[model samples]
Target: MQLKKLILLVTVLAGSYTLMAQTDKNSIDDKQNESQKKIKKSKTQLKDAEANFLLNYYEQDGDHSPVTGGRGTEKLENVAPTFVVHIPLDTVSNLDLNFGIDFYTSASTNNIDYFEGRKTGASGKDVRSHINAAYSRDLRNSGNAYSLMAGFSAEFDVTSFNFGGSYTINSKDKNRSLSLDALYMNDSWKLLYPYERRSDGTNWLKDDKRTTMKFGLSYSQVINKRLQALFSAEVVSQTGLLSTPFHRVFFDDVNGIPYDNLRSFSHVEMLDDNRLKIPVSMRLNYYLNDFMRLRTFYRFYTDSWGITAHTASIELPIQITPSLIASPFFRYHTQTSADYFYEFGQVSKAMVDAKETQFYTSDYDLSDLSSTKIGLGLQYSPLLGVGRFKSPFVKNKQVQFKSIGLRTAFYDRSDGLNAWLVSLDFAFTF
Candidate 1:
């Protein structure tokens, strides 16, 4: 039969030539593993552009606030000045960049005698300033990241901008991180005082403006192996000039001014307050070993006619060696004002009826506040000759708290007590 049909046609041509020689050795081992992963990602992006870093600072803020009888504790003497900068690159190339700047000023005339302003004559030396800037980067390796922020200020007539980004998800092996933010703000309000005298005159809106839109969501987790947690939420929606042209609202059934035929004036007439605000935050970290470390945080606030708030913080660190360390912190605050507050010269409505104030005026942001604070901070450095400080509760042989340079924090708060605060931080690399 023709040699058994030529042995089944050479066994189907030797099984299709060994399946095309193993598909050409898997296409030449996938092009030599994509050309050695693009030459190891171009030598890790040329050693992460040669890594970099920079830092600078100047700080002061003493006698923060402490007033009693002496006219609202003389506005707690505000002396605030700050500055900082940082840069880094070369963590094996995964894109990482950062920028910074923040400035604040206080001529501290006890914050203008805590608002009385010489019984009503408001002045701010010219202007109070607040500035900000930020930046972040990292993408490609997939676990993306992005950030941006802007700032401005002048008695809340500030301007702000924001942007955020984060992503990272890995299952089974466990890994999570997600973040989002988008914020915009505008604020302006300069109470009345300049107008050809008219029974405490001052009208024609100063510069009232209010605009807001904020939203955020965050997450990070690792509940074990040293503990860690983070969660966040935020929302805000405000609408234009929420009234405060100096502030003074009383009708006592119309003693004088509140709508035409006006007269009563101490301040306030820039009407327009449409708002909605909400904030929620949380953070926790624990690592009580090798040198102890602990942190906690919480925040909750609400707005929309009625107001509510809460805040808490805690920190603890004690490492005397390995470069020194010291931390002792505590914070707590409470709020419940804005239902229409008052307390100064409160009874008005008889300028033949009223210019403002009588059960729905005062508005010191609705008065109702509470506060608390205690702190201690210190950090010394010398590159930690190697290591020091260890007592995860007390494990013997580990008593560290050495000093080499700078690190200080001391603050006391309760509205005033002569308000005091100080902070100085440091780092170095080359």
Candidate 2:
């Protein structure tokens, strides 16, 4: 009986040790699993942080442009250089602050040495400057975005203030980029006119003042991974002083010297009616490949002056190789004459006498005014390195360096005025 009892106790002791060993192995397995999970989480976090850092450092968007001639609604035919800069906000939130300024010199754009015109008063060519700043922000809802912009060209003669916002709605896929935006622009149009009067006949002392408010809306759709289409429309409403005072006009009733009729003066008329205009535009962009692309657009315009026109333009960018490219563009425009447009010395004898001339007259009212523009230029972005700022920032391998656009236009007016307007643009990035 004592021997049997000893054997039973030994068996119990071995069973207890085996149970203990199994428990210890289970504990060790749990610890190893925890360590592995921690390592994987750390690696994922490191990768995410590295990507974010890269996105913030090297991302860049910039534009440098020099444009000369091409007239529309009192636009200058002179050449001007403009630079634009965009800096990232570097926050998780989609936000950015964009600021830039313009340096305008009359010497490079104008060919005149000096003229004592009634506008300049023999003061030689005047110089003008402009500055702009703005802030942009993203909305809490992934569909909305907005920005505010205000700037001044010259306090004395030029300044503008504007605010705008944009949004997209109810999209199935968040990866697809599609959105629409609307903006309002309010402005005073008295800038760039010289108020000084001197020996030169040109003077702005007796001019009518006008202010305009405009509304615009745009829609963009991503056709695919490589293509997009844009549509936009804008309307402008203008009121206030519409005519010039110093302008000369001779009435039919006043064959001789009249009490108010003026001689050799401006041709602007004073009218109680306000003005309204609408401009509609459409654009299509298609990427044939990574190195080739095509951009095309059509615009239609009309105003209160009883003028209407259509414009069509296209740009073809061909990649010669990886580092070099050539782009050619063409545009066509056709429009009717304004309601008040007239020929030289053409005035109504029945209207009230005024101090202004019947100078608003353009012989073109007898027919139609049409214009065409064609240009070709080369682009080079050689010896480039991959930008760490984004996954693919150095796209277009040849980035636009220098481009020259040459164009000529034709007009059919009663004054028999026909000429060609030439324009050129050059750009670079630093």
Candidate 3:
């Protein structure tokens, strides 16, 4: 009887152990299924993608053409079209692509090949295209974001490639933020000289490479519900050819006789190849009411070439209706001339003869000047889609128009330069 009791006790203990093992296994399976469901839900919450298109037309007319020793028509026209797309990779990452093309015609550029000593400016046209791609990701619930970008630009005589990255950190409350960015660019140029400076077949510029580096830091804060502000500072360094090859600089001889009939014959521009630049800026936005806002900006800039500049701008935006907004803006900018800048007929005969002046530029662009720009813009964005179109190649795929904007600006410079620009922008989503 004692032996039977012992066998029964062993069987009961073994059965209890097996049942506990099965329960633990089932618990693990349930935990894994719940974790997978959470992950799927997070992925499905990704945001929708968007796209934008912009077109601009600009025209300018002035009498100071640098290529002609700063004494001819500076007429130019430009048309630029740009496209941008934003795509969400997942719940915490996104990708952006941007492409743009600019077609321009400049009367000043035509002066590089002045015709038979004639004063008539040449008509020069060229095209420039650029593309940029970027990827950005948000840290896992940390309110930190990081981005990397690469870009390339190409033109008839110039090509440049750039790479950059930025990081942003936000406060726990999300009302304050800081950002840092760095960029590097490599540029190659095909040197083309003024008609008079080029010997029968010899090139003027032997070295045509340039490199640039930039660093930036910024901070943004919200002081109150109606006021927000941001501050930014940047440093830029550049090395190699900074002067335009075709810009003509005329000099007077001891006899006061201008070289080459003061028309076609002259020396090209020369300047320091290395430069450093620093700029600091601030922006403030004030929300006056549900329908009105004010934006203001100011910047201070200084450079190694002895140039100092200041810029100030203000804009007021008013919501005319639920679907319409109007904004008017004004900007003022002033800058001191570079140490080497010389206006037309301003260079002395002694300086020309000594040839000791290490730096000299007859380019008016480097001269002291003040400018003002006034602009007006209108934007239309309805709560409901304004229009939609189905893609012929993709079934059940449609694109909707979200908003449209138009802007026009008039620019005037103290140095007799003036311009007008009009731009149109459209936003869409799929």
Candidate 4:
């Protein structure tokens, strides 16, 4: 069965912000002088509060499932809905809130009780809920900003808590910027083992808690009027129980055990308790014309677990009209297998007895593989919004139906795993 909390960790780390680095340096230098002359000392007030609702659907299938000794159905489906809102707290500060829920089912996880000829108690279906909030403020006219954030997530088998903060500085001209971020997360797991192994009375793991710490740095620069680039790097460290207790690993030399009785020759997945990872990436966006733009990204990743990887991606966005934009993108990624990874039944009891196998796993997610993803995204936005209504919270104000966005993608992995994803977004301003 899949430990869904592991997937949540990846999702949390993927959060990012867009860089608005634009420099039309010779932008009629006269415009800047004239704007400064017309301006007076005043407090920065947000004209409107912003909000968005997002929904996502995902489906995938594969042949290798560690829960079944690395050979079983890996079909899964998930739907997630999220909401985000930002409210102006004062003239220079704002509060942001985000919350979401994920509902999912997995055939692989259902097989967790296969050996017992039962499926009702397995993680066949589940739901996760999460919430996060942040408070941010800008140093008046000092080109500095800072934010503090806190979040929590929970599911049937795991619960997590996280806290973080960020600081950013921008050049006076607003064409260059740097940001630093730090986060710490702690998780407590409700230990569950393979159905058969649970009755064996063996303490498979010494700990059921995990902790992660991450630090990131990023810089963005605007080049001339047509190009902008961002560079980022992050270091992540994790410790404690890192392996799934329900994942099974089979050995080849199990005294000719029947194939149907795989659990008799299987052991729980094992791995090191500590890990460190580093990833560096760069993104470049080029303005080709008023209607088209090109965006490119590249990343290099490595970890203490003897895995290295590279990823590259490109996207082209075309403006069909003043209110419509279409973007198509493609990405490719390749990575080496972890040192302790092995296929089904590739290990032996003799190796373990002789201390030749201190750590091992049959998880294909850690195996050598390549993947490709392609997608198209569309956004519809109008200058005056599609609809408007009176604001309920503010006097003499209106709420606007700002925009709608949709994106769909297909992913293919060399290991016979394939997935599809679709997402929708609704944006509003009040």
Each candidate's number of clashing pairs is: 33, 22, 0, 0
Per-residue lDDT of model 4, residues 1-430, tens digit only: 3335344464231133211101110000000000011224455644467888888788878888888777888888888888888888987888888788889888877887778877443348889898888888888779789888888889888888888888999899989999998888888997788888888889898899988888889999998799999999988888998888888888777546765666566688899999898888999999899888898998888889888888888988788887778888888888899988888878777888899878889888788988888888888887777689988888998988888888888888898988888888888888
lDDT of 1 by residue, 3-110 (tens): 111111111110011011000100100000000011245534433121112222222232221111111212222232333233334432223233333232333321
Candidate 2's C-alpha runs over 4 A off are 1-79, 92-124, 140-143, 155-159, 167-209, 225-227, 242-268, 271-273, 351-367, 383-430
TM-score computed on alpha carbons, candidate 4: 0.90
Clashing pairs in 4: none
Off by over 4 Å in 3: 1-44, 115-122, 200-206, 254-260, 263-265, 352-355
Model 4 segments beyond 4 Å from truth?
1-6, 11-43, 119-123, 254-258, 391-397
RMSD of 3: 21.1
Model 1 residue 135 lDDT score: 48
Estimate TM-scores for all models. 0.25, 0.57, 0.86, 0.90
Instruction: For residue 295, give model 4's deviation from the true position in Å.
Output: 1.0
lDDT of 2 by residue, 54-104 (tens): 000001011100100011111122222333344435331222222232222
- Residue 217 lDDT in candidate 3: 90
lDDT measured at residue 285 in model 4 versus the true structure, 0 to 100: 91
- CA-lDDT, candidates in order: 0.41, 0.38, 0.70, 0.77
Q: Against the true structure, whose TM-score is highest? A: 4
Two-way lDDT contest, 1 vs 3, winner: 3
State which candidate has the highest lDDT. 4
Question: Distance from true position, residue 162, model 4, in Å?
Answer: 0.4
